[model samples]
Target: MSSMLSLRNVWVEYGEKVVLERVDLDIAERSFVSIVGPSGAGKSTLLRLLLGQEVPTRGRILLDGVPLKPECGPDRGVVFQRYSIFPHLDARHNVLFGLECAAAPFTGRLFGRARRIALDEADAMLAAVGLGDSGHVFPAHMSGGMQQRLSIAQALVKRPRILLLDEPFGALDPGIRADMHVLVTRLWREQALTIAMVTHDISEAFTLATRVLTLDKRRHDPHAPHRYGATAVYDLTLDRRVAAETAHTASITIDDNVNN
Candidate 1:
């Protein structure tokens, strides 16, 4: 597959402190990539770069061979560790918020036919995230897993080319995290999404990611601790045969149901 995103010799600095350094990476289309490292390893910084929330001090971050803008756009979506859903809006309305914001930035409200279409899309997205029956419920009323699912739904309602996750399942329990792993993998295949997730869990990184990238500062000096920043110390691609088969089987089931 062609490269969907690339970071060429990227570096980031916060005043006198450096966060990332000499980062060169490329992500292929529709690939699930997970980033793992110790604390303050610049994993979340990398996601922020991809999200266009921060600009690199040096080098380039490219999407489809074009330099990405500093501002966020429709092409990139994100889900953070915290359930980033609206507290005031219900599940369905939260999903609709993305469509609303994209369609009308100043006023996040739709009307008439546009409103109907957005509602329909929101319903489909809620169903896709297994929150169909929870459309009327608020995020506070839902479980952690359910809230995370709703966050995913809200992000995907825009059909972004890339999804950036920052410790998406960090707060969930083991069982719920496992369920989220399956849900994310299924969604990646079904939606043909290119994903970049940052997590501290080694197992979760290995389980959900086709490619794993480790970021940490390579050089350490007792006298000068903050001289250097984190780099991509390890990049490994796993065998995704099992994931492929699972997605294929699910696709077949859907097709059979549609045909029947």
Candidate 2:
């Protein structure tokens, strides 16, 4: 497992306010990492940095040992807390849209063999995320869990090297969320994706991540509470067996659904 991404003494600030400070981490290939923290702890900020949505005020972010550019690219994909799917498009088209946007940015359309290939890929991606039969339905008609699965499929249609998730299951019911847990773990394994997820649920973080990172404001100063920003306060590498058990249990849950 070589390092896929690395943050070296990263810092991010907006105007007079600081959001992150001295954040250093190395993310291995095919690793599932979950980030947890209190409110105002800059968890989203970290995700944005990785997504290349925002550049660090100082320091560097590297991918494959090269400095990462400060912009989103095909190499990385993201699923936000919100469904992030278009209401008008059906599930299949929603996934196809990602391919079109990436392949034909100016016209936002795909044609000929490229179009057929993308559509075929989209169908496979939708089915992989457990929405094979629902491709004709719009997001508005789908349940909360289904919409989230659609979101995941859209991100994955591009076959990104890294996947970033922001509270992907926060809006679902408990049972649906559990099913999603299984779906996501299965996708991670089958696709060999390097994942970085931001989740407020401590239990969810512990359950899904091979590595857990806790971010918080680490420096305390009586003069200015906000002067210092958040950083990785705790990093835990779970035992291999624990992660295996979680994936195993989630698989059983998915199997039960099929039987039912």
Candidate 3:
């Protein structure tokens, strides 16, 4: 219920073009927030700001009431639409890489007892993502769903406080996307993670998120579209009971479609 992330009058501009302006938001701890908007609405840009990959052109961003760092840190983990795993490494090793990087930044490797422990943790994370038996499988041999599970495992191995998802299931088949929906919902509950996901699907936004945010330009300039920037035009907070009902209804709808 406490605020985990706060953006105060944030703005992101590039030279003469403005992307986001006068954006103010407060994301609570352990809350699942879904961002939905049209193309060029700066949805991904907002996600990047939260990931510490980009800083605001003005205003301040606070994490747990402290000023956020300018670089990405272990406290936040991100899963992109494309699988961000190493093709050469197997599932276990791919997950292990995160631990190794955090433990040994200079060499990005571990050894002996440390190596064994890290592998155990990696296997545990893989199991959590339903890839326990596939630890030895290479990503190239795995199906799309399996590869995405591996990607989630890799992001989660570091045990980040916040998880940022950018159209993570957009590329999957409908059946696979439904399965991933269940997987992500379960993980979000089990891990008690604060998730901020940018999605193109309106149904997905309502189904998975405790809060839904729509970004768009409040005032458009016909002469110069770039003269204005997008902001949170609509913010809707769903009650827990309503969110559960929505998820249930969505699941049934997906099941019916798949059956047909």
Candidate 4:
């Protein structure tokens, strides 16, 4: 598989504090990558880098072999743990916002034929995320899962090639999180997206991703904790079948332990 995104010798430093160092990675096209790490290990920072929201203090990032722009581009879309949507707008308008912005930067609104076409696209994307009937609903009226579904639709409506998820399911209940997993998996497959998700859930990381990466510091300074930075210490690629089997076995083991 060809690389869709590449990072070479990437480092993120804020003053004397180093968050990440010597980070080199290649994310293949259509691959689902889950990033896991301890607190302050730079997982979210890594996602920000992928989203073009942050530039590494040292080194570079490349998308499709070209140098990545510092600004967030339309090619990359992001969903956060907190619902990133317009509370005032209905679901349809929230999803239509991106298209409108892209079409008319100055006005941030589409007119007549263009507005109609954008609305149709937004509706289709809402349907794709199982929000077909909720287009007119406000965020305050929706459940957490529904809000997340709307968030996904909003991100996907723009037809971004890469999706960046920052602990997207962290705030949801287990059942809701499971449903989101199914939704995200289906979207990833159907959209042929290259996804980079940051999560604290190990099971989720292992279950949903084609590749799992663990970031940690190779060397730690006890006196000055920020002296060293986290890097990808473990990079494991899994076949879909293998990932399923492993996740299943893990589930059984956890269940048995709980019962015992």
Candidates in order have lDDT scores of 0.88, 0.89, 0.92, 0.91
Which parts of model 1 have CA positions greater than 4 angstroms off?
242-260
What's the ranking of the predictions by lDDT, best on top? Answer: 3, 4, 2, 1
* Candidate 2 worst ten-residue window by lDDT: 251-260
Model 4 local distance difference test score: 0.91
Tens-place lDDT per residue, model 4, 98-179, is 9999999999999999999999999999999999999999999999999999999989998999999999999999999999
Rank order (by TM-score, best first): 4, 3, 2, 1
**Model 2, range 26-140, lDDT digits (tens) per residue?**
9999999999777788999999999999999999999999999989988898998788899999999999999998999999999999999999999999999999999899988
Best by TM-score: 4
> What would the TM-score be for candidate 1 when compared with the true structure?
0.92
The digit string of per-residue lDDT tens for model 3 on 1-260 reads 99999999999999989999999999999999999777898999999999999999999999999999999999999999999999999999999999999999999999999999999999999999999999999999999999999999988989999999999999999999999999999999999999999998878878889998888888788999997999998787987667756855754553353234
How many pairs collide in each candidate, listed in order? 0, 0, 0, 0
Q: Could you estimate the TM-score for every candidate? A: 0.92, 0.92, 0.94, 0.95
TM-score of 4: 0.95
Superposed on all Cα atoms, the candidates' RMSDs to the truth, in angstroms, are 8.9, 6.8, 4.8, 3.6
